[model samples]
Target: MEEIFENRGLGLGLSFSGLNGIVTYYDYNLDDNQQLHYSLELTGQQVGNSFKALRLTEESTDMQSISKSGSGNSLEIDRILVSGTYRWFVDESLVWGISEGLFYGAGGGFGYSTLKYQGERYKYGSQHIR
Candidate 1:
């Protein structure tokens, strides 16, 4: 503990930031009694962080030394999404405007999504720890 008391240097830093977005959608009427709706979405993200330090230290033996250390990390990600829906009207005509009350037949829907990820860590310089 006496040797550690001879060195007096400390440093700390932290930062975080990000940006994300992306998508599209569409709807079509196959007929007066049939409707088809579909949509597509895409997204990509990248992030990085780094830490570095340089300092001077002294020992109880009356000796002086220089210390250098550094570390870093990085990441990348990509994603995709697709979806679709189909609706049918059995009653055909039962409205005068709004299209939410004509659904009376069986319908089918489907969706698909995918994601890709990559990451890496790096270190530089060197230091001797007590």
Candidate 2:
């Protein structure tokens, strides 16, 4: 179970600290609440300290080759996603002190990600000389 979390978080460009960090989103209502809702999303997370993706153990094999391969540096990545939404309320009614509402919405988000790292990188069968 823990490995599942680590893999998911790392895949999303996050360190261990980020996993423990609080993840929250904010929403805002426009001047008029009936017809529309607009929100400016500002979300980000940063690791306070440095960490290594691949951990080494005393019984690990080929540690020398692995150490010599990857450069000694921390990798940093930044991702920005901007989006907007438009929703229409079909109907709303109060039942048993609960508000029952029907809404239709269409929204999309575009994400631009940038990576900055000074180390060896590779993909597929190719190996980066640098």
Candidate 3:
């Protein structure tokens, strides 16, 4: 388990606040040759914006499999993430924001640092404000 805290500021003044937590665990049964896995993740953020916007999300998944030894096995996965609206400050306590924005991200994973899997994933998402 782990926890994190972060903040962003400009010119000696705080501008944003953020926090997150993560948990992970794995279990194996020697007698039955079964395996179990678990994970949890969550995050929250606050940005300086006039619209006062907030977002929250959560996800969970479960899987069960039979081992080669004829034993039952189970696996579980979960994740949570949240992001707040970006705030553009025109003045003290005054903010500005656009109705729309663009986002781009990329990620990849390899097997044992040998580039065997060569799997890659990318995501692009946008949000609108009223």
In model 2, the clashing pairs are none
- Two-way TM-score contest, 2 vs 3, winner: 2
The local distance difference test score of each candidate is: 0.40, 0.38, 0.25
- Model 1, poorest ten-residue lDDT window? 59-68
lDDT of 3 by residue, 1-130 (tens): 6855323221211222232223233322222222222323232211112113222222221111111122322322222432222222233233335523222223232211111111233369899999
Best by lDDT: 1
Top model by TM-score, which number? Answer: 2
Q: Write the per-residue lDDT of candidate 1 for residues 1-130, one digit (tens) a residue.
A: 3533211222222222121324455657676566665655443331111111211212221111111123322233444456666767665355557764567544344544333323343458798999
Residue 80 of candidate 1: its Cα lDDT? 49
What lDDT score is found at residue 53 in candidate 1? 20
Candidates ranked by TM-score: 2, 1, 3
lDDT, model 2, position 20: 24
Residue 60 of model 2 has an lDDT of 31
Model 3, runs deviating above 4 Å = 1-20, 26-33, 45-130
Q: Write the per-residue lDDT of candidate 2 for residues 19-72, one digit (tens) a residue.
A: 222122333433223333333222222322222223322333221121223356
* Model with the higher TM-score, candidate 1 or 3: 1
